[model samples]
Target: MKLRNLPPLALAAAVGVALTACSPSEPEPEESAPESASPSAPPTSEAAPAAVLPTGEPQVLATGLDVPWSVAFLGETALISSRDDGDVLELLPDGGTRVIGTVDGVVHDGESGLLGLAVDDQGRLYAYSTGEDGNRIERYGFTGEPGSLALGTGETLLEGIPAASYHDGGRIAIGPDGMLYAATGDAGNPDDAQDLDSLGGKILRMTLDGAVPEDNPFAGSLVYSYGHRNPQGIAWAADGTMFAAEFGQNTWDELNIVEPGGNYGWPEVEGIAEEGDFIDPVQQWSPEEASPSGIAVVEGTVFIANLRGEVLRAVPVADPGTATEYYAGEFGRIRAVTASPGGDLWFTTSNTDGRGDPSGDDDRLVGVEVG
Candidate 1:
């Protein structure tokens, strides 16, 4: 389809500056400041300086995409996955899109369809999608370079993940340890979060070939952590610390530092309980202000994309207790965000995902530089 890209730096100079909220109350490490999480006062940390915030407005890289979900880089080239039709699109130099290939057997409705995409260091492409059988992850072989890209038949890596209209955790990433980590929701049943035998409500890890690693916490299993409600975002700090964002029922949402075999207290608790029964989130917020979806760690900062809150948030790694918000309500709903190969931050909007208001220029892929 024909899409348009505005001049790279045009938007920043042409439009007025966006409002940025860089509030850091406690400066303590967010992992230790769960007590500060509340609707009136979010965890505060000023470790991230104002200089790290994005400079100027985000420029539209490509517009007119239909319900785009995830972004992956095959070198400098950007590939986007469509959540509605399961098609993979490659961005051209001229700002248009070419269909690389369509994922077959993807069943779409509600929050299900083709959701996440990842490219391994060896050039293999991985995707997470929903099907009649359930949710599954498939690996595909890639041939050719940017602009002339091609995807071979998909090989199902793992299948039978619990799926539902909501809580179908679909984010997948290849960790620094070269293992595949996947986030799965409770699939509408909170009890499943406590069931070790079920894959739902846990972050599962395995080899690239889909076999459970011998060193996994549970013997002969893929469950990395348990007791999660609807975790959709996962990332890692440079020091090898793992972080995740989870959606709470109605009271609070969470950001947690993940540990192997750790229990995150979903049905038993929502936020910081000061109890030892389960792991508490480092920071928590009301669902009305945060529906944190996709997150990426960049240059010591964690950037998050929120669906219901309609903002792109930044959390400093040094003191996660603090947060800086950008583009609040300026763009409809942000679904995906990642660091581009060229060192810029790229994100997508979710207006066409049925939960947001869509404009003629909605569902765009935008790129911006983070100072």
Candidate 2:
């Protein structure tokens, strides 16, 4: 959600303007063709059958969310985080929602607020939020079931991460190794991306208790990989390879296959740099084409939610660079995407976050079939 200063005309032309939760009320005005058009339909001919693209419609699960940032599952229920309001809401199977708890000391600035969320096998909940001091991760224990849920006092897992108005990266997930993995931005300072000693601009690995794992790439440090501008999505494939979605400054957004102690070359390189020392992104897109936010891997495909692109891109795990656009310009400014228990994809819209046009049901959660 960084890069907030781009002109609306440029953004609208690059990616269509945000639509309502369901669809666009009016047709978008024609503009100059973008560098690449959204995947087009195959031409029909008597010689051959038309190609069939992956097709699935989004079902709106819940509405009236105020900038819902992340979604995590606790059993069959879904827990959603509201960025500006610091509220954690529980969405039941019947589409009912209830406030489970409000995170204390959240500062809802330009792009900093309550962000990423994760749940462990023990049903413990983890949240990343912006506080007065900086960005912090907190763990909470849940007491009740879906309808009536109560959260315990939050236990601070980690703190002292740099925070800023724009680039405070905030995505956390439990890796397949049973360790906690967190992504942090450069806090609006590009130089911080190259500084390995700083916690900003890196993927951090730690135990559930916030202790550095003994097998970490960096001995006695939590830094797993360095040289990232603002990475907001982390998901592990069944084979244990980690993939992250990152926001680029102005030129490129990246989908990176993360390796331990790898350098991504942030300030030095934006997208695919054939430079010797830097690891290139598996896939790259223009920032206008993809202000990519949250990502999830389901059934061997990586589903990336795009904010500026206004689409859910399904990229096959075997094929990294290619993607099929689903619901392009339909759900509006997708902020978070996660795999549901039933093997479907659940995502949230960000139209209410002072950027896109808000429909009456703006910032809602929608579900789509993945397989």
Candidate number of the best TM-score? 1
Q: Over the stretch 207-293, how does candidate 2's per-residue lDDT look in tens digits?
A: 999999999998999999999999999998767779999999988898888989999999999988878788888778898878999
Tell me the tens digit of each residue's lDDT in model 1 across 1-371: 11122234444333321212222221121222345552233333444333255654456677788999999988778889999899999987655788899898999979899989999998889999999999999999877777899899899999999999889888899998999999999989999999999999999999999999999999999999999999889998776778898888998888888899999998898887767889877777778778999998887788888889888888777666567777778678998998887667889999999999987767888776776
Candidate 2 TM-score, C-alpha based: 0.86
Candidate 2: C-alpha RMSD to true structure equals 9.3
TM-score for every candidate vs. truth?
0.88, 0.86
Candidate 1 lDDT score at position 192: 92
Clash numbers, per candidate: 5, 0
* Model 2 misplaced regions, further than 4 Å: 1-55
Clashes of 1: 5
